[model samples]
Target: MPDPIYVPVLKARQAELAALSEIQPATRKAILPVLEIAPSEVDDPQVVSDAVDRISKKLEVWGGNELIVDAGFLSAGIRLPSGQGATMYATAKARSLGIGAIPVARLSDGDSARADVRNLQVEYDCGVAVRLSMEDMDEDPEELDSSITALLGDVSVRRDQADLILDLASVQGDIAVRGGSRIVLDVLRELEKVEQWRRVIVTSGAFPVDLSSVVPWVQSEFQRYDAALWDAIRGRRRLPRIPIYGDYSVAFPLLVSGPPFAPAPQLRYTLGDRWLFLKGRKNDPRGSEQFYEVCEQVAMHSEFAGAALGTADARIASPREHGPGNGSTWRKIGTVHHLDFVVGRITTLGEP
Candidate 1:
């Protein structure tokens, strides 16, 4: 039996599926922070409470939008050291806050993936929602397609009553590259052939790349790739019906319904400061200077005119040496700094 609370949500989704064709393209900006909580803190009630509060505050800033709690980062098997999963705790907390939660499933093998789905069905029984992140998709395209088909078939047969959200981050590829766009389009084309799973939510658009490695001349080309891919999707007449979500990294909405826009000013300012700080720490200032020059090129690009330098901040903590060296082990103490950004938000036409 399904949880009584989840039955209504499922019913609402079913109704929406029927009316997908008539839906309108509505755009809204939102921030989705994917929280990474350590396992040591998971067992502590107070620690978990504090972490949940912090996440809740972020959601509140976004006007209480649905929270996407990723379970993949927890551990390989989706279980903590205690056997109980962090995903369960996060989902429960989100529900208690009267906000919907989407848990991402990240299993290693096909058998484990199917088993995880069944377990979620039996455990939650109500409000069961799970997302299959594209990053977990098998490298072989045929195998991936078959796996997805089989997973959906199992869901339909078991009546698991789980809402499946497909995170397309991995599929969309890096915006700076051309092949990624083509791959995403191919995947979408293949999925379109499967009629039963047409209603699943699709997260479209690519995550932003680190500006440190990008060429100044190719900045405009990156924006062009993103624009062309989106235009192709729209030309296929699959906007409101298919439902696509945009990434906060690019600051572009789900669909290209209007002219291009820039990321928030604050995002730009913070990223610039982060880049300068990283450059200051580097032994070769020339590399950092070139990186900034490319950023300027991106800002001046016609497609991204008025856009801010949307670079990401990254850091690595470890000693320079490990293992035995000479008579005794020698270690150089320091941290390495790199730049990387995470995509924010999974904007959907309706609540996931």
Candidate 2:
């Protein structure tokens, strides 16, 4: 597969997958998503297995397509994880399905993880994506090179075909955004000292994890610093290379644990480089009814992409179709719109 114009680092949640299902086929070609599988979502092997099964089936549609799949969340909480592990169960449990799932191997991953990544690289005949986080980048550039070179060797991937990813996840404040841009240039400076990579992706997320600070019933606007950070890097003069732009869409970079804390009906509408965050009171008796008004507001807004834009836009435009859905539904709506909007934005990038 050729290099993608956008790389959306997404959590493998139901809402995220649902949004992916709604994206137009032509739009899907613009993004190569890095799917993260969290093992802590469920404890029971059966349930986790079922979720992984569903994930595989959802991804099977993109068979013969390129996608980076990381079961690295397994590094934290072990359970039935990995698209590699999921699809391994595919042939024995169900009929065979083909998917060009490029495995990811981290510097801290164990021997088993390396083996799994290597097996996948060989099976698909594609190289792996090495995602270096702030923790990994904390080391000096020389040490950074050492760890990354060792990781690529462990996965047995040639540098020319490997994807070097700089994951600066969750740069929430202005200070962090500036720091993020600096990191991007620093990594680029280091890459100039190394061999060529098939693709160099910079991923980060600035979406606040919760809407706790916003006043209830107030529609607040927040900057998409993640986008701003990328723009700053692209606008910088004398850059080594223009790496691929990536972010977590509407989701935060750091994964939160426990049950979702969606206390009220909230709407996240992507308008240009900012999010129109609208929220209802917490613990309101009318569950999700606030979404109707929220949808109405979005539908009436000039930035609204109209009902025909995508499934989520259609839902936001038509409040009568079904009950105002819950938080997950809103996430799906927000993400679909974000994906649709950003795909076009990146196509005609004016940041530089």
Candidate 3:
């Protein structure tokens, strides 16, 4: 069948909004450390002003310390900031705060530890918490994505789980296979222990995927990604950032009378930093009130850099009166996560 007819007005509006240049909320100015006037300096207005000027310059010299990196165990007593939305807000803001600290606590090693970190961030509505230091994306693109992809493999599959001894690994167009006689053996092993696997039900924006190479059994997965990517790319100027190493799960919360659809919560998992962005629906006239509360809570807590709790603009299309689910209609909600908001080149692979 021929492709469906395309419209441009709404798509154009969406593209405009998506590409509309706006200052990121968490910027250098927001993170400048406030200088307290010392008694000596305060006695002289000029001294106080000089101190303030010095502090400002120092902060600038820090080059936007929005993300901080540190190692070694920190006290569990390090409590999150109080207030409802503080954690969420702080985490989102933390990124721009440049506070990308990586604590080297013994408890943060290996898969179990990593899983705990991911889960903690998700539960707390922390936007994009990462156990690892931010990786350099400017390096070779192929090498960077490949390293991340491998790291993700280790994170997802535990040693206690089925042993997947991939004798050969390759990214051919769209087909991914760990060849060798153990390939089938690994699948069987994993199936036997499937109960231990975490079942992630993805309910967020779609991403792009090449369809030609996906195995028939997993074609549905590819289709879902296709829909999401296609929806996002409409009237698109630049490519929408796709999931390179993360798992996203969404939950729909019931709403009172604002809209017919429920507000959905989205959880995004990434390698460098992990955070969960949640967007829920509210009935108040100025619906942003509750979200702001949550954002404030995240901000005060050191555990999260900050969070982005706001109305989500992405949507999944619904079925028409006599048509299949369009997969484009979006319900309003808030989202938070720690994955880098960057796009990469589309990859294609062919099956051998």
Q: Pick the candidate with the highest TM-score.
A: 2
Q: Give the worst 10-residue stretch by lDDT in candidate 1.
A: 327-336
Instruction: Output the better candidate (1/3) by TM-score.
Output: 1
Top lDDT hit: 2
| Candidate numbers, best TM-score first, in rank order | 2, 1, 3
> What are the runs in model 2 whose C-alpha is more than 4 Å off?
41-48, 76-96, 192-195, 282-285, 350-352
Point out the worst 10-residue segment of candidate 2 by lDDT: 87-96
Writing each residue's lDDT as its tens digit, candidate 3 over 117-154 gives 34424553222212221122223445533543454343
Listed per model in order, the count of residue pairs whose N, CA or C atoms clash below 3 Å is 0, 0, 62
Check candidate 1 and list the clashing pairs. Answer: none
The list of candidate 1 runs beyond 4 A from truth reads: 1-65, 78-83, 107-142, 149-178, 198-228, 236-243, 248-352
In candidate 2, what are the lDDT values of residues 144-247, reduced to their tens digit? 88878777888788888788888999877788888888878877887544448888888998788877889977778888888888888887777888888898
- Sort order, lDDT high to low: 2, 1, 3
Q: Candidates' lDDT values, in order?
A: 0.34, 0.75, 0.24
lDDT (tens digit, per residue) of candidate 1 on 242-276 = 42432322222122233333211111211211122
